[model samples]
Structures are given as C-alpha cells and as structure tokens.
Target: PEVIYLAGIIDRTPSSIAMRLVNFASVDPFHQNRGIAGLSGGKKQVEPIWKEFIDNKEDLLFESEKILAEKESVSIDKKFAHMLIGIENLVGESKTREVKVRVNQSVFRQIVLANYSSKCAISGIDVPELLVASHIIPWSKNEKERLNPENGICLSSMYDKAFDKGLIGLKLDHSIVISEKLRSNRIKPYYKQFFAPLEKLKIASPQKYLPKPEFLEYHLDVVFMK
Candidate 1:
C-alpha cells in the first residue's frame, strides 16, 4: 500500500527494504521459506513489504482486542461474547490472515457509526444495518486515508450509492450540494425531504469525523455531474 511504501522510504534506504523482506518472508511460517530465499534484494529493497506486513500484524494483534470494547459499537458490544466465540474460530489451527481483514473492517464500521451516532449523515436514517461508513475519498485511491475516520461519512444505503456515484456532493462547509440532474428530476421532492435539509444542518457531530476538504473538492469537481 502507498502508506506502507511511503513509510519505508521515510524510515529506511532502498537496500534495507530488500533485506528485511527476505528475512521476514523466511521467518513467517505461514509463507514458504523457499520463496523468501528466492527473494534476492538487499534490506533496503524489501523494507516496504516487511514494514507493511509487520504493521498489519501489529494492528491485528493489538486492535483486535479493542474490537470487544463497548465504546466502538453498541450493537457489537451487546453481542461481544458471541463475537468472541466467532473470533476464537480463527485462532490456533484455524487461524487465517483473512480474520485480520474482517477485524479491520469491523473497526472501520464501528468508527463510522460511532461518529454519526449510527445515523446517516445526509438522511439522518438511524437503521444500523442500512448504514455504511462510506469513504469520502475512494478507498482504492488513497492508502494513507484507508482507515482514517475523517476520510469516512456515515450514509444510508440509497444515499451512499448516490454519494459514491457523485449524484451529490458536500461543500467544505458541510452544506449539501445537489447535482443539477437530481435537482431537476421528478424525484426532487424525495431528494429534498432527505437531502435538501442537510444544507442547513451543521454536521451533527463534527467531533466524530471531519470530512477531508481535498476529498470533498475531488467529489465536487470530478464526481458530481453538476
């Protein structure tokens, strides 16, 4: 990921990156030792990959426990005991790296929901299952912002689709901006009911997450048809 590679550049020379990768790949029991040995770079060349893997591993080990904490998600907390049982399935002989991915996603979702009071940012819909922690900046476009809560906005399923497709955008001041097409559509009333009022509403919980201005600008300029 860009964040991983960037950190490698910041912290280590190219030669160190290479050697570290070989060493990590060799010692990681889950990976084949032969593959590690086949890697033929100095420490600098392998630094990026090594750093990322180590970082992910550390996050998994540390943050996975935090997942059980009630502050993250009330729903998850209510069923925390059951969740622990499911997590146990991934431990020991059944352990898989995918478990970490699941945990990461959970963490992201909790962060988003907590920030929005489990309500959609635009529609104020409070249905937990229907809400999404949609990234303001496309997740694939920015690795550095991948897990940044400020990079996310809580959105309902329908509005999430609209926002993701650029049918709507938010001004830096957090006012809703409807695309001309949407404003002119027959469904304008429906849109107005849920979205138009947002223009006047200050962000409900600015403390939970602040939308990145650059990402908002990207949506306004490129994504919103207007």
Candidate 2:
C-alpha cells in the first residue's frame, strides 16, 4: 500500500518503486556484506543519492520528506502537524532549528522501525507507541552520526531507558548484556522476568543497516555499566 501510494505521487509503477528500493539495497553495506545482490543496472543511478545521504543525512532526509509532502500537495508543516505542536509561537532561526530537529527525529524513528520490521529488537514488541529509536552512541556525543541508521536500534520503552541509562548494553556480537547494576536485582520478580532472560541473548537482526561495530564499541566503553 505504501509503495502504491508513493508510486502514485511520483507517477511511477509500484514495481518501479520497489525496484528502486532494491537498487538502494544493492548499495547498502548490510546487504552487500550478506552477499545479497539487487538489480545491478540501476545501482549506479542510486549511488549519488546514497552517498549524499551518507555525507549529510540531516539535510537530505528533511529535504526528501519536504519533497514528498510537496508532491502530495501538502505543506511540510501540515504533513507533520502532530509533531509541530507547541512550537507555533517561536519565530526566526530558533523555530527553524527546532522544526528541523523534530522532523529529523521523526525520520530517524521511521527508519529504525522499518529496519527492524516495526518490532523491538530485544523484546519483539510490535506496538508502535511502545517502540523507540534508541541510539547506540548518545545523540549529544556524536553529531556526525547522529542520524545514521547504523547508530540506531529499535527497542521497547523499558529497554530504551535501560540502554540510555547504561543499565543494559549490546556486545559486539549483538547479544544483550545486563549491567551488574541491573543484575543486582536478580532476586526481584521484574528482574527475573525482564533482565535475566535478556542476558547474552542475541537481538533480532535488522532488515538493513545493522548497528555499526564501532558504535557498539563506543557504547560499551563510554555508556555501558561495567
């Protein structure tokens, strides 16, 4: 349905839209590493756009959303009205900055959700409201990779807070690791039901943009509780 909707807006067939996505997969490092090949002929055509996304994700993603909104005959502000609430009074550069941040954050969440098939990587929770686009590296700590899909993980709200607080972490192999702080509560029912089961368990692999090893290492070194 989404492909058909996008195809109608772009004046392309659904097959073509799907093929374009495949072309994107062709250049994706995750797919390439897994030996999956997309249509080779269109790979070159998508390379430049992919490179641009890698270089300046914030601008590219926001502009892409704006373009989509325009093509659908809607203002970007209207399209994202739900997220723009409470920012109406601000004017000038501050307003622009805040809007961009909110929109980009929305885009990041969408990408992470799509990558994980809209399920939490740890708990497999499929409820959208319960999910979060958890950053492996603290967002404030890494500006360059702030919007990188490889730096994000799909997690339930409980695990997201746990991760953010360094109460849980991921090993390089993608297995969950419980912090000693969390393990200290092993005798508690909540710990028995939640934290204990997750220890050393592998997270579900994303469809694309697997978390980068470097980002995981950074989390382990700086964010993870020893």
- Going through the candidates in order, what is the number of backbone clashes in each? 18, 0
Question: Compared to the true structure, candidate 2 yields what TM-score?
Answer: 0.89
Candidate 1 residue-wise lDDT, 1-226, digit = tens = 6335544545666665555655666544335533435344443555566567555643643354454343334543244443344566466534444444455556777888888889987767899889998878877777666676777899899888888888778888888777777767636677658666654565555443578788889778877878
| Deviating ranges (above 4 Å) for candidate 1 | 1-98, 186-189, 195-202
- What lDDT is reached at residue 119 by model 1? 91
Candidate 2: where is the Cα deviation over 4 Å?
Answer: 18-27, 40-45
Candidate 2 local lDDT, 53-155, one digit each (tens):
8889888888898999999999988999988999999999998888888899998999999999999999999999999999999989998898989999999
User: Which 10 residues in a row give candidate 1 its minimum summed lDDT?
Assistant: 75-84
Choose the strongest candidate by TM-score: 2
Q: TM-score, each model?
A: 0.56, 0.89
lDDT of each: 0.66, 0.92
